[model samples]
Target: MKKQNIYILAIESSCDDTSAAVMCNDTTLSNVVATQKIHEEYGGVVPELASRAHQQNIVPVIHQALTKAKIDKNQLSAIAFTRGPGLMGSLLVGTSFAKSLALGLGIPLIEVNHMQAHILAHFIREEGFDRPDFPFLALTISGGHTQIVLVRNYFDMEILGETLDDAVGEAFDKTAKIIGLPYPGGPLVDKLALKGNPQAYPFPKPKVKGLNFSFSGLKTSILYFIQRETAANPNFIEQNREDICASIQYTIVEILMDKLKKAVKQTGIKRVAIGGGVSANSGIRIALKNTESQLGWTTYIPKFEYCTDNAAMIGIVGYLKFREGKFTDQSVTAKARYIIP
Candidate 1:
């Protein structure tokens, strides 16, 4: 008997980006993303506009993914999509498309939790990179979420700690906005931080208990501090932009690291991994690496491409679930808030 090959088409439209990927078995053959620039002018995502953009981009993005992978729609064994913890409208676009496609092709449909996809991204096969072992700690930080999760196996996770209010990525963007920076200012702050003194301005760290984290107080402190400084000297921010950025980034990194340390101690798991958008920050990367040396710990960090929201991550999870025959029915709908069990 000849072995059957499995090809999966994955779609990710959780928030602003419309992405699609073609994965054969465990390898991702092609990944294409169409980022919504429409959100930039609005300082953040407007849910309605995001959905409209996804509707426009989804077709072409999937077409490109299939084309690049040299696979036809008929070859797909299943269709997988983010079911969410994201905007309702945006998620509906992808969910509807995936359901329609699966129905037309007479294939199975898989619903992937967005956050779980982020954690499993580390398992994508890559040369010279080993995936984290079972029972490791994962720090999942992004624009909307900040969490320390304990992973025991594929889809088996426990939330050791998470944000009490605003996420770390929000802390970064909000600080940037307060300093007169434009939308998507987190990366800009990171770039400027490289040239400034991280200790130039001291921000208060939240004294949250246990492995949980909080950035709401830090954001408030930054807002008030900036206001007070500008009142004293209107040019303070302009003249000290670099240092201020550096300080903010430094404080955020410290808070994240502090909680990660506690989680490690609590779990006795030295193998740590990080995912989500904020994991792309250079400072956080360096800090994690430092722990590998200083604390004799092992760390796993995804490539820049996989660090952000993309269908490839969803594809990886889909492939794993396909092996177990875990498929969803046509009735599965996009969820605005889905938690990992």
Candidate 2:
């Protein structure tokens, strides 16, 4: 049974985002996310630097979450943290902190999978939203991951398919760079693509043979095309900005939504949801809404708050685990490749 007044202090440092959240029962009391801006200079996240930033940001982030939630440290029933499927060093900081906090707070410690937490974000309460039932299908996309998942329960998760080469967010980032967008340019690409014609340049679609995906060809195609086009016109991208961005964004969105459609058909599952950072893309959301209507299925997308990395999602999953008497020991270790379906 679900517990009452079960306040949880959750920590998330899976990647470039350092976050903390407080959960009271099933509701998120407060969520604080600190994103690393240093990656902007390097054009992508650097593991070592990300870890360092986590070390610096975690303490303050947690303090802020608790402060905003109006919950005292002694009020927490348990401590929850993302334990795996992220950078090793970054995960370590959150793990070690959670372990220490649980020990100090004298409560149970619940370890969470970053990917699974993305799925469970649906459980975080919002006034007008409803939580998903069991056997739900999730399309989780991020800079590090692109996967279709099946959630049978709080603990039972399986991965249906994933990218064989690059993740969907990676494709977006790479494509954005090719188009001269700033670092973490995936969102920008989507925005610019809206102003441009989607058919300006046809990008190659990955014929990945199976449920697995490959975006290497698509990235290479863009790179080569850009190189050749710029060689002739130097200002080719500048001149046809909207078209290039639109075409690439269109192709990537199609690739993702197509695979998602197939996953639905093959599994005979009507309920569909999308999560992770890229789930915030306007293009993906619009496509999912349209597809859901055409396919006659219920579609779930977390509000932007839960879409990005946040400890509230972790805390929500931890709440479920806590109810099931799930707890982690001191020997619990961080895993860098946590997968779920």
Q: What is the C-alpha lDDT of each candidate?
A: 0.94, 0.90
True-structure lDDT of candidate 1: 0.94
What's the distance in Å from true for residue 32, model 1?
Answer: 0.3
Q: Report per-prediction Cα RMSD to one decimal.
A: 0.9, 1.6
- Lowest-lDDT window of 10 residues in candidate 2? 332-341
TM-score of the candidate numbered 1? 0.99
Look at candidate 1 and give me any clashing residue pairs. Answer: none
Q: Which number leads on lDDT?
A: 1
TM-score of each: 0.99, 0.97
lDDT of 1 by residue, 1-341 (tens): 98788899999999999999999987889989999998899999999999999999999999999999999999999999999989999999999999999999999999999999999999988777789989999999999999999999997899989999999889999999999999898999999999999999999998999888889899899999999999999999999999999999999999999999988888899999999999989999999999899999999998778999999999999999999999999999999999985
lDDT of 2 at 306: 95
